[model samples]
Target: MPEFKQFLLADTAEGLTEAEILSVRVQPGDEVTVNQVVCEVETAKAAVELPIPWAGKVTEILVEPGQTVEVGAPILTVDVDPAGGASVNGSAPAAEEEMKPLVGYGSKTVTTKRRARREVTPEAPVTKGGYVPLAKPPVRKLAKELGVDLRALATSVDGVITREDVQRAAAPAAPTAPAAAPVSSGARERRVPIKGVRKATAQAMVSSAFTAPHVTEFLTVDVTPMMELREKLKKHPSFAGVKLTPLAFAAKAVCLAVKRTPDVNASWDEAAGEIVYKDYVHLGIAAATPRGLVVPKIRDADAMSLAELAAALEQLTTTAREGKTPPADMLGGTITITNVGVFGVDTGTPIINPGESAILAFGAIKDMPWVVDGQLAVRKVLQLALSFDHRLVDGQQGSQFLADVGAILADPAMAITY
Candidate 1:
């Protein structure tokens, strides 16, 4: 008698929650082993490669790419045996099922037929006359960027074309004037439909901004010493190829400040009748991805060095830009920092991400006139804004915490004393 084991789904670093299948890597009859790469999944955070735990021949892929799947749902099936050879045709060996963990370990045998899916109308329809009219999501987004029209593509489908079809069609017609205006907007204004990260962010921001009484405080600091230290460190062989920004130093400063001011590292629990101050810091870095703004937290960021923090920030930004950040990395954040300086913008009074008590916004660094040692001179200066909930923190405490962070960034050497 042959035995079987099902490899249940574990957390994919950047997979979706409702299980949308993006792509499948293996097929039936393929022999696989434990820890072998099974598939690549696209989640809210980043694209993650999933590993198969049990070794066996591939039986069937239950889901297809582009379809979302729920957690704990059966993703794949495999056969296991005492002799190391299991077949799907063999009877259910009771011994194997008995050994399976009851909860959260492996896949459970769900007895239900798959549901039929509804038909989806393509945005661009393939019409007769040799014109294939259709656009994928990326193409649609590109068209919005380039100001192309799906209706125009449909009316003038010259050949079997895709999103690449629409792009090629609009590329040569560049009149260099007003032809690139968005079709969705007025002749002067354009409107792009909200979807993906932008859509999710809009919904979340609306909920947070409307629900919370947001209060933001700003502080302009002379970070000349910090900037000088960063320039010196950039020349070091260890800091090669890393994009060293003042924001990195700012992140470290925030972490150090949180160590002394634990109240700022907390969440509001309305149901529990308490403001929970966390002993551990899950430092959230707000990243602006193509999808929208996402806050992926670095677990125990307080324990990492400046180099480690730089690497983590690099990983987070890259994963975020690629739309592969894991859902787990987005959770459990007590405080957040958003660097709007990348866009060359000054400080913004940002709204706090719900559940987190405070969020700091870092603005662009620019040369400005300042008084140094009672003399007016040009120096590199930057602004920092801290938005917090007055319900959890008072103005005095918030001011002091912001001051401490500014003091650290103003003199990177002070971090050693603090």
Candidate 2:
């Protein structure tokens, strides 16, 4: 008789409660070796591939994709040899030393392999042009933005509708903008489920907004000197192979400014009825990805050089935008910066991340008339907005912190004073 071994879903990292089953890679009776990836899951963090620790034949797949299951729950069951000799399909049992630890090693060596994707079928036919066309999430979002009805081109395409089709469909009139989603005649609304990163972000924002008394301050600065210095640094041999960005300069500035106004780097300890202050800075850069907005931190950012900061920022944001930022990377942020300027916006109030007292919003850089030595002339100007927890940081402290950041950006030399 074959003995059965139930494979339980383990917590991939700290504070993991549960995860959504993203996909199952094996079917019942499929032979698997030790450490063979069996499924993929999406936690509040990132997508993780789970590998079976035991070599056996997959007896049952207990859960389906998109279902949320708690940690320690059985995700699948495998049949093993009763005597623990040869395993599934007569393969020798894996050596004990070669097996990955089951508890927290859920994602280690979890290779990325493309599983044949399931066909996406439209759910309803109540739209203006009939049932929605078959397309991936990104393609759908693109079509909606371009105003090209999916149903209109559904018949023209053989299978899934590509982004090119939508762009081509909308080229006649709104050539620049692809138009989709004819909502005039059909259902007035659709709902997106709040889960994963989106769900976690909603909860955090609400909690932070309600618990922290937020105070935001704004400043405008001429960044011509900073921009000029940046160009000079780009040509320097030491800065080569580094991706220098304005955000990096802002990060370096924030670190320098924190030395003077440490209150912005502190967090409120409500449970302890005291304030927690730190000498070191774990600077978080707010990133926008397909999943949602995530702020991953640069550990000990205060100690890094400008070049190091720039390289770290490049790696951090790229990982985030790819939706591969690990759960551990997203935790323990001391302060955050959101570069809204990349989207060409002037400035807006930003919310502070949880556990941190302050968040900075860096706005677009533009040429504006400025008074230089009492003469109005065109200069590169940038806007800054700083939001802080009023309960922890007083108005004066917040303003000073914002001023310190702006001063460094306006004149990089000002950082030396801080």
State the lDDT at 103 in candidate 2: 40
How big is the RMSD of model 1?
13.5
The CA lDDT of each predicted structure is: 0.71, 0.81
Cα miss at 74, model 2 (Å)?
Answer: 1.4
lDDT of 1 at 137: 46
Winning candidate number (TM-score): 2
lDDT of 1 by residue, 1-418 (tens): 4555554445443233333556677886677777777776655444566777667777666677766554444566666443555554443323234333213334544332232322223664534563434444445544654576654563222222244556575677645665665556558887664444564566457656765567789999998888899999999988888877787898899999987777778887754778898887788899877666789988898888887788888988888888878666787898999999888888999888877878999999999999999999988899999998788888887888899999999888889976
RMSD of each: 13.5, 14.7
Provide the lDDT at 5 for model 1: 55
Q: Please list the residue runs of candidate 2 whose C-alpha ends up more than 4 Å from where it truly belongs after superposition.
A: 80-188
Q: Which lDDT tens digits does candidate 2 get at residues 1-418? A: 5656677777777667678999999998688887898999888878778777888687677899989886656787677663554344433222221223354565453211222333333553345755455675546655765677777664333465765677788787644666776755448767677788887788678668877899899999999999999999999998999989888899999999999999999998864789999999999999999988888889999999999999999999999998888888888999999999999999999988988999999999999999999999999999999999999899999999898888899899987787
The superposed Cα distance between candidate 1 and the true structure at residue 220, in angstroms, equals 2.0
Give each model a TM-score.
Answer: 0.67, 0.75
Off by over 4 Å in 1: 1-17, 79-204, 235-243, 290-292, 305-308, 318-327, 413-417
